[model samples]
Target: IQKLAGGDICKGRIDVYPKTRENIQVALRVSRVNQLLGADFSAEQIKEIISRLGLKVEAAIKGGTLQIEIPGFRPDLTREVDVIEEIARVDGFDKVDTIFPVASVRPVRIALRQTMLRKIREVLCHTGFSETVHFSFVECEQAENYLSSFASTEDKVISLKNPLSSENDTMRTSLIPGLLKTIQNNLSKGQKPLKLFEIGSVYFIDSQGKRVQKTVLTAAVLGPYELTPWKPRGKEYDFYDLKGALDNLCSHFGLQVGFPANANRSYLLEEKSANCYVDANELGYIGQLSPDKTEIAEKVFVWELDLQKLEKSLPPRPHFQNIAKFPETYRDISILVDRQVTSQKASDLILKAGQPLLKRVELYDHFEGKKIQSDKKSLTFALSFQSKDKTLSDDEVSPLFETIVQTLKTELDASLRE
Candidate 1:
């Protein structure tokens, strides 16, 4: 082409491109070529291919790496894979074997925290709550209102050193505010019966005065309990509905948890909220959102569990218990206790008093009106008595029932209701 152009385009040898520059030298391994192409090409064949392509090919060193000097014209051939491609092109693409590359794969061990996160997501999804994701930022006022409860001091709001905007200047200390915002947004669009959840980090300063970020699982529910063909507007979701969802989650993880009294938050209705616990440590809080927090007319219930604490609270691999071959005996017991005494405390007392024979304890009824004393409340529990080896007889369960009643009366000053 230069000769036809009749210009000094190729006068003498203009070394515009460096032929032997170190930048153009690429190391190639015969094994790597075969590994990539899934073909067993010999070193001799690869070397011959490079020579034919007008590129310099050094003899293979002890490590089987051949130093191939790329030509100025073939500037693209700067890496081992590039030479492998050239070999594949010259060796006839059809001749390259079509086979799975040899590899040794091992199962990747997943972190337990990650596993729990995935499981929590699955459980929440199965429980009819749609998952939501939001930015880690919130307004300064919302952060102060919702997050002050989590920090030991009021000014622990974690502000961004360089935030994107004035609106999202601070990290969220609690997921409740975000969930409330979501509820408001959804309600504005005429979406009803909102059941939503989020699993993310909440930032705060701990008692030790260190900035901390914790993973939290939070869920919110509003509107009807259930929507059905028969009842267009089903019963509105009460505190128990939200509690039942928390119970469902606890049951799934085999976590032995309880709702202790007076788990209050500034935004939560004091009488409708309780602190959840695993052992003695506080796990989280669940309550009815105070009406003042939102413009939504219907009541909203939400629960936020410290996922970090929850991960620690998760029970060990449960040992399989054989299905009971014998029948279970049911007993009804109603107790009169002071209004201040929690049903959970009574239930725990009953479990302790009726151990070994007490298979289940369920609170079926709670009354506080004229049917009970003014200063006290009545809690009716359906107790199940069962033995793993044989059916429980009335004679065998009577002593335990009496013991439970006496224990409650002695320990909690609770009397068996007539």
Candidate 2:
């Protein structure tokens, strides 16, 4: 109805909309015979040529040549070539020369952004993650419920006014819900130890009252990642296992990954989840899928990342350095701190104090046993110290390591675990 009201009469092409007037009008300046056909001719010759095309020739132009108004029905009459073609139609096509067009091909380099994304997908696939794809359109209930963590009130979901079915009536707000359903279906089919991924779009409204979409990469793991022989004991897939996959992905592109300073307070996690970021943008969240959100009996660890944001955050040029020639001095220690104190805090302090020679800090173990305080947790880290020019000795590595341990003790009330 809107198309008809707007005067779209052509089947595929949009017809001229005569909103301001009852009919569309166009002016066509009749060029000289020399300009039109590359041949000199008199006014009468031009008029005679136009008269042959059934157009009424009017007064002369500034150079004393014929100019006339083109009819609305003749939409093709706008420029000199158009007029020349009409003249040619009355003239002879046999006289015009025809030439075949030439074709050329050149190889082009792939864009860095696209190359980065391709490498990401390849890395994930190589890490035993099978890619899954699904319909972009989804149920309204799905869209409203599985909104992205970064969504705001303006990020309204888009729903088709006329839909094929309720199952696919609206655009998805995130990919996790679909991925969860995929996991569920796989489990029902007796497929366990599943690791799946998807790269797709999530649709939402922008602040300017327009619909927008963001591309994301989402992955999920269920059951055990490795099949073990029938045994009484075997640990299932955990959050770190999924995180390790993601960490491995970021490392491929030289992308930096970080987590919030505090445990997520916005239901990101009560304990097991942490929001991941690249260059301060909340790319996505990696956490355990809550039971309420799924019927799958086994635990599921999921990671959702914004590949578009990841592309934007990639450095223009990646830095490369040779491995340190001197062997690294290693230190492993366990510190007891309040449960609320994040491991990131301790790691940052270790990096800060060990700035001159501290090579790397890694959390190797975490424990909250019966012997430990109820309100506190035991965190273990592996610290590596190295010097570019000389070997780092125990005398040099110990004091730097001890200074960081003391900083943790003073700053977070952390104590070295016996």
Candidate 3:
């Protein structure tokens, strides 16, 4: 038998594998066993059950406790709960009374951030942008190039220690690269009116060399604005289409943001791009992609925003208001301001100066023609006025209207266009 077991019988030597049972001792308490099983189990009864299972039991250091030594064959008997389970098994589980666990039941709530993200997704989907998902792994060079203009020179892209491939060795610092690739692929497949968005984590290494990860919302619109049977060659999407989609998202969240001209992004057209902000906190940027950088014949517009910052800027849950008892009257004003003066600046001034009575402001017209000075532009805004308590007479609106006009003139040097 020894020879058959590959033992050196001729040398008068044989190795008994697993020479002794493993020395695993578990302390089983009488009170704990009774409490768990809901049965009055004395220490002697537990010891008798354990001994029946071929386990050696000894008196534990503390009274009413037993030290149980588990056999190598009974590998499952390593914990005190295992001993209790065995006692229950030997004593017959049918004897144990059925008792439902007691716990406080409450309705599960969806987290606020999660709800916010879902709303963002819903708004973008309704605004004609399709959501996309891409691998977090990105090309090192592509990631670096995208982060270069926005991130400081000291900041770097986080690289993988054990990369699957050289091409995807680094974590993405921006979602734009992946979305750009998606655009290229879809365009190649002849997909038109392509609008895509993604909500995903972007990785970065701060100036302090700490790896940082953040959630960002990125969206892009390309191809035609819309396809119509009448027009086989539809109008291509422009900067406004991108901004309008962004506005839809912000409006849904009750977030008011500003777009000031920014020339920092290398991937976007300097003249076309603007930085998005809520007060002084910068949320992100929106603009037309630089044709040379994107290498696409058709124009592409995109925006990327920090979702955390966006969440911070979102207004509280809006209070319900009854429909106005009175009618809303609108007044139109066209102002001629210098070419460099943004329409947003003029609109903000109007909103501030025309408050209390001014309910809404809409820039309905923007014209730059031979009639206007070469260095100036024409902007027309429709101001809606309404009173909650009473119908607003022209007397009430006229003064606010003149105040708005005068404020625009004094602050922006804007001349009221006849």
Q: Let me know the TM-score candidate 2 reaches against the reference structure.
A: 0.72
Q: How would you order the candidates by TM-score, starting with the best?
A: 3, 1, 2
Model-by-model lDDT, in order?
0.84, 0.77, 0.85
Instruction: List residue ranges in candidate 2 displaced over 4 A.
Output: 1-105, 228-233, 261-268
lDDT for 60 in candidate 1 is 49
lDDT of 2: 0.77
CA RMSD, predictions in order: 6.3, 12.2, 7.5
| Model 3 weakest 10-residue run by lDDT | 225-234
For all predicted structures, in order, the TM-scores are: 0.73, 0.72, 0.73
| Candidate 1: tens digits of C-alpha lDDT, residues 132-206 | 989999988888878744555544788898999998999998888778888988888988888999988889766
Model 1 TM-score on a 0 to 1 scale: 0.73
lDDT against true structure, model 3: 0.85
What does candidate 3's lDDT look like per residue over 1-418, in tens digits?
Answer: 7657766446665558757666787888889999899999777888888899999987553788888888788877778898899899999999999888889999989988999999988888887789999999988988888885346678999999999999899999889888888888988998877889999989989999888888999998877657567544657777876887788778777777787657487888876788998888888898888888777887888898988888887777875778888999989999999988888889989999999889888887888899989998999999999988998898888999999989998999999998
Off by over 4 Å in 3: 1-95, 106-108, 139-141, 148-150, 159-169, 228-233, 261-263, 315-317, 369-373
